[model samples]
Target: MPRSHPNSVTIPVGVVVRRTPGVTRWAKYAWTVTDILPGAAPADWKVLRSEGDVTEYHAATLPLTLYVPDAEAYAHELQARIPSIYTVLRPNAESGGVPWSVALVTASPYEAQDYCDSAEELVEKLPMPHGLHALIVEFVDKHYEEEAFVKRRRKNARVDQTDDGIGDARIRQTTDVYRAPRRREVAN
Candidate 1:
């Protein structure tokens, strides 16, 4: 890695999803991400396990990237009872294919929140594996520098000394109907 971008690293991650019978009447089947594998090889809907009515598949291998700038967000997640990695899945609308595809994998909660705001994408949380957790902690320890809190001061300008934008400048006071004489009203 270059010195300019030493704080960033990518780790291969596999998304394992489970398919089950849909509870609703409109849908035939339901899908959900069950687990994540650290340093897993690339795969596409390869069956991992099957039990009764449920089946698990290795959907896709995505790169889980860690960045130094987002260390604070990662720290927040680490404080939780179970630190997790968020996966965003986009609906697949193309004919004759799986119902969903892996869109993004994010460690930062803020970034994951942005995806949640959109209606088109679905977000799933999976427990962070020990190996990935160590990598995140090591990366945070090496490059996570606590930024100092600096109080922002407003610009030094006299605001109460002027009426620059108080009223409508386009309408002259002498020609304004609100300020015009009542004689014009009586004459109408």
Candidate 2:
């Protein structure tokens, strides 16, 4: 059974963005965030820290976590922003390659604003659909971390000997049900 958490909700999110011509080759490759897993975003969902000479966008599709009552409304707004040709994205589920709108809101408003600004710049530079200026920001809570909480199984061997008979009889067996310890980072 899947473990449930009180603070976490899982939902699909649509990360939609228009592609531009003459953009960096990297930028061209990065527009699939709406279609692919981690599409254009980073693995951790933190604004990808830039590397020297790397073309990382200031505003990329960010994964948002939603817990408020109005999250569904927000998702609808995001859904409205997407083109009909594109479908919303569900984790591990392909909506015919269409990016789906998510119900999550921005965890960081500042990040959203930065993304908007960068998207605006790209919109201005590219000859895209009219009024397609800002990128769409959608949130969904249905996404789960792809990493499992437990590790793979392994076997262990053990032997038991009778003390009363000076090891006259012994038993040996192998079992594999060990689980690794979960590590927690301490807050300073």
Candidate 3:
């Protein structure tokens, strides 16, 4: 059975989104968030910068929930050259501008894979802050345990040597129907 951390910690992280005119023919605009703000207050999509048509915003504040059960996964994330927290996003139907909704902030690769598999959403990787990395390492050192992987052997099946009813009966019965008639060779 899987274990859960009774006292899980939730850290507030601000998401910064950069919205620019789409270069592709299929899309009119591109939306992406790659910078995380630690200890940021909750806010809706508030414009941070605007030049010409390109704009950047402090999109939203999302909670990065860390659990003891997921400490191993977190440790793996931290080992990366640039550890990232993934956020899942999708276009809002009601607004022409992109809105913050259904964003998932997580450190686990397994959890990130779930968002990556979705067709209707986009997964953005933001670099994890240095302070947050230290916090995760401390949690991992306390609770993370390396699990041993076991390979299971398949059961052997007994071989039947008897020829009676060995072949497919349907194919045998239909052979004559599908076979063409043999031609006789005429001597010249």
Candidate 4:
């Protein structure tokens, strides 16, 4: 991990993924990210362990950047039932390559949600390591500042002030004429 500036720390994180024999006839293997190794040496598809057909590979080493601006997001993740680090993987690897490629590693659930919404990449949530948890706590304590809650005062603005019904939906199932809204003619 390298402290690039006073506001951010960049740690080299290794993405470990496991491959298991697929249960279905259409799928050959089920690929999932298992764990992340902080301060890990750079690796690419390095076999870490094997038990029968289940194999774990250090697929890629990516830089996990922690910023002061994102401290609130980290705090939210840490406060979850299970603190997690999210990893995103892309399918359709080239020939001879693995079934998946490491697309991104993030600490923010908001960022993870963006990738999940795309539906083109696979997102995996791994338990946060204890060391990393401690490190993040320290970082959060040092950088995070809870913003003061300011309750928004409702302005006394009325939506039907002018009654511009140009875009109103005239078609409705109910035929009750009295239930329909009428534009009040404002006295000039």
Candidate 5:
């Protein structure tokens, strides 16, 4: 069973959502959130500016839990162009509306791999705030240890040629499946 680091912290973060009109090759009109706002407040989403079909919303403020075991992974994630907090979104079961149920993922890659395989869930990467980055770095420096990668050598197989191939006439037979035909034979 997998375990989470005992020293895990939950921090509150805001998500920004934008509803934009998109046209497919089939000329189908679809409304999708093209931009995500991170570290946004609930009030921000409420007062979003809407011009025509383009609307911006501050979606929700939710708790992002960071585990100590994933500190190293977080450190690696910080190196990305946009070091982000990953959010998992799914359709709201009760609302029957466009709004989605959101979850902030702070797990390491090893732990989060299971969630990646879900087709129905939408995974969004929101840029991490400077302050949050500092905090995560501090946690990682204190707890994260770089694991040494050692390559294992394959075991050598014991060869007993006399028993397996030398005495057997079938082994020496030039079967069509195992042997290439001579070029001269092919030309003839």
Candidate 6:
């Protein structure tokens, strides 16, 4: 027999963090939906994955943002803690570092799709921190954004297309090209 769950929906999601100058790294703690908006839902966002033996844990982006005086230093710090992908849009004549934001984005594993949906819905239902909303909100923003992108594999296909939720559905039957972990790569 298959496993049973009361509420289940597929969603591809990740966490977004906003960094600002002079703000304490601890400012992320105040990012709770409550801190950002009154009457907002609780900050307890569950990631919906099994971490060891625990069924449920206080799962969220963990810390949404970390303010650093220097971008390169911050990048090094972030690269060390959670390595995924990162983008650094430097402040320039058009932009200033007096106020800047850093977004740390990551994909949640597929098995937690349902919980991902619920967590996303909760964030959407609540208002986000000012200015930070646009950057971070898009992660949970529905209607305009699809939880995951779906492409047509075939024009004459029977059921449109399905979203496997991990970047591309074509990966479902694809082979991963793996290179052995290197010590030098870790030193970086």
Residue 144 C-alpha lDDT in model 2: 23
After TM-score superposition, the amount by which residue 32's alpha carbon in candidate 2 deviates from its true location, in angstroms, is 5.7
Q: Given candidate 4, what's the lDDT at residue 155?
A: 95
RMSD (Cα, Å) for all candidates, in order, is: 5.6, 19.6, 6.7, 8.3, 5.7, 23.0
Decreasing TM-score order of the candidates? 4, 1, 3, 5, 2, 6
In candidate 4, position 55 carries an lDDT of 96
Model 3 residue 94 CA deviation in Å: 2.2
Task: Name the top lDDT candidate.
Answer: 4
Model 6 vs. true fold: TM: 0.17
lDDT per residue (tens digit) for residues 1-188 in model 1: 22235758988999998999999999888999989998899998899999998999999999888877788888888878999999999998773558998888878888899999999998998888898899888877887677899998779966677554435667665454445356545554
Task: Show the lowest summed lDDT stretch of 10 residues, model 2.
Answer: 121-130
Error (Å) of candidate 1 at residue 159 is: 14
Kindly list the per-residue Cα lDDT of model 5 for residues 1-188, writing each as its tens digit: 33455798776666666666666676323433344443555543353678987776666677666777667788788667777667666666876434566654453544455567988777765566778878787877887888899988658854544443334465555444435556665554
Per-residue lDDT for 1-188 in model 6, tens only?
13233322222223322222224775422222212221223233333344443332222232233221222332333234332222221122433322222222222222123334543222211223334434333323322222366774756755756644344454663433353445765554
Minimal lDDT window, size 10, model 1: 173-182
- How do the residues 1-188 of candidate 3 rate in per-residue lDDT, one tens digit apiece? 23346768888988888888999999888788858788899878888899998998888888888998778889899889898888877767778456446467788887888878878888887888889888888888888889899887557843555545335555646344435667999999
lDDT per model vs. reference = 0.84, 0.34, 0.79, 0.87, 0.62, 0.30
Candidate 4 residue pairs in backbone clash? none
Q: Kindly report which residue stretches of model 6 are placed more than 4 angstroms away from their true locations once superposed.
A: 1-42, 45-53, 60-63, 66-68, 77-188
TM-score for each prediction? 0.77, 0.22, 0.73, 0.77, 0.64, 0.17
Compare candidates 1 and 2 on TM-score and give the better one.
Answer: 1
Alpha-carbon runs more than 4 Å astray in model 1: 1-4, 157-188
For residue 78, model 3's alpha carbon misses the true position, in angstroms, by 1.6
Candidate 2 vs candidate 6: which has greater TM-score? 2
Which lDDT tens digits does candidate 4 get at residues 1-188? 34465779778899999999999999898998888999999998999999999999999999888888889999999999999999999985594658788978888888888898987899999999998889888988999999999988669866656653444447654444446677999998
Better of 1 and 3 by lDDT: 1
Pairs clashing in candidate 1? none
